[model samples]
Target: MPAPRIKICGVTQAATLHACIAARADYVGFNFCPPSPRFLSLPAARDLGAQANGRITRVGLFVDADPATIAEAVEAAGLDAIQLHGSEAPQTVAALKARHGLPVWKVISVSGAADLAPAARYAQAADLVLLDAKTPKGALAGGLGLKFDWTLLAAWRPSGPWGLAGGLNPANVAEAVRVTGAPLVDTASGVETAPGVKDMDLIAAFCQAARS
Candidate 1:
């Protein structure tokens, strides 16, 4: 099988953003969700996004943010894509795609096989459907280092483009791809030493492992 594409998310600093580019990450995600430790202000995102614009794909991560807020971030950051991590309806995803004229990725919080059902709803609305582990009620949506059963995806096939996230790290990402045959893989907290603290070595290791 071809090596999976890699996305390094929750990047907060210029050095880390440059590390991701040097590491050949396919995409770099900037968190727009206020509650997450990796959240980026508009100014921070713009600076990082400028550095990432041509060298790597820049994706803005949001969680049920109002369209106006999202619009501001997209414009400020020159986002190439928008990734939704909330309970947005298909219409919301479609509308965002129409509004921004960019690829929209919908994250599905998977706990069981039933959770996979939501991907079908986003077939046309989303450019990519990302499967992430489900967090507890009142907790942050993702980037918690929580992992789900990768085997749960063994028998499933998605109609649209898709990727896998949730507790993927340098040590285990190869196994994750082997088990699920994921075409793309994403990581946020997995490459971090602490909450929102990205480790350069970990970032390099993750990229190498995901492609290995």
Candidate 2:
């Protein structure tokens, strides 16, 4: 099988962006949610995105942000795609894709087989679907560093392209691929030394392991 595409999310610094690129990451993500420690200001994200120019895809990550917020980030950050990591509906995904003329990746939190049903709802609107671990009630979306059962995806399929994420580290990435056959894989806290702080060595290891 072809190697799975790797997307390193929650990148907040230029150094981290460079590390991801050096690791040959297929996509580098920037958090736009202000509450996140990995959040980047428009200018900061713009600078880092410029550094990634053409070497890898630049993705802007957002929660349930308003359209204006997304528009500003896209303009300022030069994003190639937008990842909606919130409780957005299918219509919202379609609207964002149409408004920005960019690919939209919708994140679905899954803890059981039933959670997989939502993928079909989003597939009609989103260009890609990201299956991530469900966060605890009343918690923010994503970057929780929690993992769900990979076995739940053993026979899983989606209406569109899809990816696997949440708590995926270098140590288990190969096994993740072996089990789920996910075409893409995304990570954030898994490569971090602390919450929102990415470690270069871990980043490199994850990319290498996933590629191998």
Best by lDDT: 1
lDDT of 2 by residue, 57-101 (tens): 999999999999999999888999999999889999999998999
Candidate 1 residue-wise lDDT, 1-212, digit = tens: 89999999999999999999999999999999999999999999889988887899999999999999999999999999999999999999999998889999999999999999889999999999999999999999999999999999988989889999999999999999999989999999999989999999999999999999
Give the range where candidate 1 is weakest over 10 consecutive residues by summed lDDT. Answer: 45-54
TM-scores of the models, in the given order? 0.99, 0.98
Candidate 1 error regions (>4 Å): none
Q: Which residue pairs collide, candidate 1? A: none
- Compared with the true structure, all predictions reach lDDT values of 0.95, 0.92
